[model samples]
Target: MKIFRKLRLQELLYNKKDKRLATAIKLMVGRKPLNLSLFKLAVKHSSAAEETKHGIKVSNERLEYLGDAVLGTIVAEHLFIKFPYRDEGFLTETRSRIVNRESLNQVGKKIGLEKIVESDLTEKGFFTHKSIYGDTLEALVGAVYLDRGYYFCRKFVLSRIISPHFDLDNIINTTINFKSKIIEWSQKENREVDFLLKSITGSQRFKEFTVELKIDQEFFTEGKGPTKKKAEQEAAKNACEKLKLAI
Candidate 1:
């Protein structure tokens, strides 16, 4: 039975499709994949979902869901160990910043994950759709977990994703509360700082807020975001950049 199974597996891998997927995954993960099917599903987008032999649809979404939880846990554990003296709020904020959509998208793109994503991005162009890369990044994590278990998956995330891509010092010291930072800077400089909501536009689901910052009665900068708080932060960040302030 063992001999037969080994031969069957060899035959399966000899097929062109399996070989291609196996090669791609090995390049991405820096190791050979045990189960090419799982990796295939990991790179598959929901738009390219197909029915299985049992009439069940399979896509990367389920793997993405699992990867999300796994990634969060690993990140939390990393932060906990890395910053033993930090508070819960600090850890949570750091984790959020690391795993935010934009960060994930940048990581995914940097790692060439978008090359393997099966999506019909003719209209908007693949580069324009950041979510695809981000989702694929999560799904790839799920695939690693399933094929190699949590230990190897955690190691891969740390060595390949976190260590290589992220600057730990920069992420830790990043000023998330830019509004507060600007306020403190203003107080130190004895300058009055104010954030004025200039305009609110778009529908409820797609609303945009524009905020303008005034420092000592002079218009410093303007920014826009999806929410008022975010707009204010963006404006503050712009102000910080304009003034060459170290955040």
Candidate 2:
């Protein structure tokens, strides 16, 4: 059993296609019995290899498929219990926003998934891309579910992966249309506003995009985040609240 497991790990680690992903597995599942193949399969983008020699292609799409279902079910249960009064539409939209690629990417980057998981080879850059990282995160969940029983997997996901960073209330309510509110307030005040992506720090996945909001050449506020849109929204929200233009 031990030899078989080690061989499987060897195959996953030594394979040219999957070699670049060694660091990612260690970063996320350190000291845990978490099967490394699950993560490798998770990070394998369809673009990496269309097919293997035996006429089988490795891709995270299937894992992603399973992950999508798992994520929806978990989030649904959380919502159902958390907000007994929330209608189906509200719960669905809220879950959608939380599990969407952009949001998942933000979560992954916030947790530093990119730092430990990356391709040393310049051959592919999906590790640092949110579109892929987010998808892979989902696939990883699927893999964990398969390796471990549902209860243990669910517990790990809830306690470690999903719960710490996920603030359902803040996500649902606080991220209101800050930009739109700023625009309306600016119009009311007869002032023009601008949001510029000034500079960017960090990689594409864990990036900190800097944004500057100016009103009629006067700098209103500055903000930074993983996405330009998010930073700009922060700047806008700050400007609005500070100026008492809009709530």
lDDT of 2 at 110: 69
lDDT values of the candidates?
0.85, 0.71
Candidate 2, residues 1-247: lDDT per residue as tens digits?
6686655555544665455455545456442434666776766666664576899877888998998788778777877788899899788868876777766766666666565343333535543443666776787778777766577667766776668878777777865787899889878879999998899988756889999999998887998877888898889867765764423
Question: Best lDDT goes to which candidate?
Answer: 1
Question: Candidate 1, residue 64: CA error in Å?
Answer: 0.3
Which digits, one per residue and each the tens of the lDDT, describe model 1 over residues 74-112? 999999999999999899978977886778878999999
TM-score of every prediction relative to native:
0.68, 0.57
Q: For all candidates, what are the clash counts?
A: 0, 0
For candidate 2, the 10 contiguous residues with the lowest summed lDDT are 115-124
Candidate 2, residue 238: the lDDT equals 78
By summed lDDT, the worst window of 10 consecutive residues in model 1 runs over: 4-13
